[model samples]
Target: TQLLEQSPQFLSIQEGENLTVYCNSSSVFSSLQWYRQEPGEGPVLLVTVVTGGEVKKLKRLTFQFGDARKDSSLHITAAQPGDTGLYLCAWEGYNKLIFGAGTRLAVHP
Candidate 1:
């Protein structure tokens, strides 16, 4: 069963624009993580929001965990072309990672 759902599975935007993608689940999670993957590359951990209502930032990206830990959001401010990639919301599972359907973002210069 799919435990998570991501919205706007595809997004195309101009550089400098801000955007946000979401990950949601009906069941609460102990922790949630966000990963980004570029073409021909493995997904890399961006940020992990472990606590409810917790927020973490990495340069222009911001990750937030819902108070109930049932959802999460990733916001990018002034997004750049370098940010173009597949964004996956996931959770650590038995030393592996279970991912979302993923949000593919393309930022044009």
Candidate 2:
């Protein structure tokens, strides 16, 4: 069985703060995707990093895939109130998906 474990299931931060969330697993995955979801809507794809040690940045958000492809991390710099939402990390392969427990971020302005 494959499972993804996420740290700090809930985070509350003041606006303009920095935070980092982590996803870890023992099994390797073909692809890892990060998504941000708002209330009553599906998760929006933030980024996908396939190569190990590869980092992708979108504005104040940065994502990294583990060298073994079994883990990933997301870092937000100077977060804003708009960043308050649920962040999820998912592993996809062979028409199957494994999702993390999900992290709920609250950015207070």
Candidate 3:
């Protein structure tokens, strides 16, 4: 089982800017997932990357898994204020999910 660690515990940016966040682990994972959470709400799954070197795009957001399956990244283009929230990365481990320390993003309009 891998222990995930996310970078840039907090970020504040202006609208229309771009940013990237990362999640890394020493152990390999079968899959990795990204999620977004708003205050007072449960996290909402964004994307899941399974195969190594795979990339997935959702509107202005992009997700990628490292070739070794030990790291992942999330990129946002032209970020909007609505994008403000907590971003999390999780991987399946021992029949449960091991989540990284989340990144809190605040996009100012």
Candidate 4:
């Protein structure tokens, strides 16, 4: 099974601020994904990075995968209160998916 470690377990910021979070692992993964979740709901996939060093942007959000394929990061620009939620990283391993502990974000307006 692939193991993921997420940094800065929690974060709080004002709207319009920018922030970044990270997910890392010792084992290489074929693909990595980012997700956002709201309270009492399931996580929503934001982006998936497969090629090493690949970068994908969704609106004000950006995702990058490590050249070694063992790490990833997410950056959000001009945060909004609507961005408040749980962010997670997941990877496929041994025919299953393993998730990180997750980062909880609170953006106050």
lDDT per model, in order? 0.94, 0.90, 0.94, 0.94
lDDT of 3 by residue, 1-109 (tens): 3388898899999999999999999988889999999999999999999999999999999999999999999999999999999999998768887789899999999
Model 1 Cα lDDT, one tens digit per residue, 1-109: 6788998899999999999999999989899989999999999988889999999989999999999999999999999999999999998878987899999999999
Question: Which ranges of candidate 1 are over 4 A from the true structure?
Answer: none
Candidate 3 achieves a global lDDT of 0.94
In TM-score terms, candidate 1 sits at 0.96
Candidate 2 residue pairs in clash (backbone atoms < 3 Å):
none
lDDT of 4 by residue, 6-109 (tens): 97899999999999999999988899999999999999999889999999999999999999999999999999999999999999768877899999999999
- Kindly give the stretch of ten consecutive residues in candidate 4 with the minimal lDDT sum: 1-10
For every model in order, what is the number of clashing pairs? 0, 0, 0, 0
Alpha-carbon deviation at 33 in model 3, angstroms: 0.7
Judging by TM-score, tell me the better candidate of 1 and 4: 1
What does candidate 2's lDDT look like per residue over 4-50, in tens digits? 88878999999999999998998887779998998889999899989
Please give the distance, in angstroms, between residue 62's alpha carbon in candidate 3 and its true position after superposition.
Answer: 0.3
Q: Give the TM-score (vs. native) of candidate 2.
A: 0.94
Scored by lDDT, model 1 comes in at: 0.94
| Rank order (by TM-score, best first) | 1, 3, 4, 2
Clashing pairs in 4: none
Q: Predict model 4's lDDT versus the native.
A: 0.94
